[model samples]
Target: MRKLQQRLDKIKDNNQAADALAGRRSEVKPESASPVAPERSRGRRRGWLIVLGMVVFGFVFGELALTVQGWSGPDFSDARRVGKATVVSCERRGPIGWGIGYWDQCTADVVWDGGFSGRYAIDRRNFFHADEVGTTVTIGEGAGSRGGGVVFSRPELPHRPAVVALGWGLAVIASIPILLLLGGTFVAARDAIRGVSKR
Candidate 1:
């Protein structure tokens, strides 16, 4: 009887061990056997998202660069009569960048032939002629045939090449960050989609 009982206990122990092994195998089968391909696919998809983001960033940078480059110009307005004289000046009311400058026109009545005459005058004593392009005009204290030359105003032909170049450079630099963000978002979205599909 003792031997038989011992044999029964051994059989029970063997059954329990077998059951534990079976449970472990079942748990591992679904987790470790499959889904490797899906994981790899997800990684590749993430990489593609990064690439797409880079392209978008490049486009944005290029656009910004073009916009900045287009801003290199003198703000000018058509000739208009202020008081009694016609004046034409560059109307720049904002900050001037490296390659930008402001020009203004101020005019007043002048005595000509003992009669009031309308004349056009630039903001400063510097007489800016249409023919004088790419030239700097310095306005100083002086009165001319027109009314008092526009008080203290000057025209400067700033170095535009550097400004344009810098703008382009900055645009290019900004593209990198934009690309990174876009790529990250795309990859994340793609992964999410894939996960949903798998589910």
Candidate 2:
């Protein structure tokens, strides 16, 4: 009976020691259940900050693309041409006009007399004389020598709506990344704030 009593006493002492150790551990750190919450919130905030930085970079890139694609200013002054007659060798005249076959059209200021001057289109088709003013100049569009002169007519260029549309499309596409980044940042910030508030 004495031996049985001693065994029971030993068991009780062991259980008491285990309970005391558990109590000490609990008191040492009371917030062990949710220690990772603040860390997760901070990580989310950092992610949002990174996204905002990326958005700013995307906006700058988009602006640069727009500036590059837009027209800077009007065409140069050499685009205008004025002279007395084709026989006078207007090619030697200062600031006469952009040369023939150039992309831009040249307008000739033909001076017949001291006071008689008229504007004419100088292109591959029509060579204007002083007397040709006020007369209808017909430009040919067919092949061969018959059609290869600049008549008094406006030059036609290919339609460029497709190019304009393509430029706009590219600009919008480049902006999409910025938009998404902003949205993601907003969502992350909101979530982080809510998490902090809940804590």
Model 1 lDDT tens row, 3-37: 99999999999999999999888788665688898
Candidate 2: residue 167 lDDT (0-100): 53
* Model 2 lDDT at residue 13: 100
Lowest lDDT 10-residue stretch of candidate 1: 75-84
Candidates' TM-scores? 0.33, 0.39
Q: Which predicted model would earn the best TM-score?
A: 2
RMSD of each: 13.4, 14.8
Which residue pairs collide in model 2, if any? 82-109, 124-150, 125-149, 125-150, 126-149, 126-150
Query: How far out, in Å, is residue 76 in model 2?
Result: 12
TM-score of 1: 0.33
Q: Candidate 1: lDDT over CA atoms?
A: 0.52
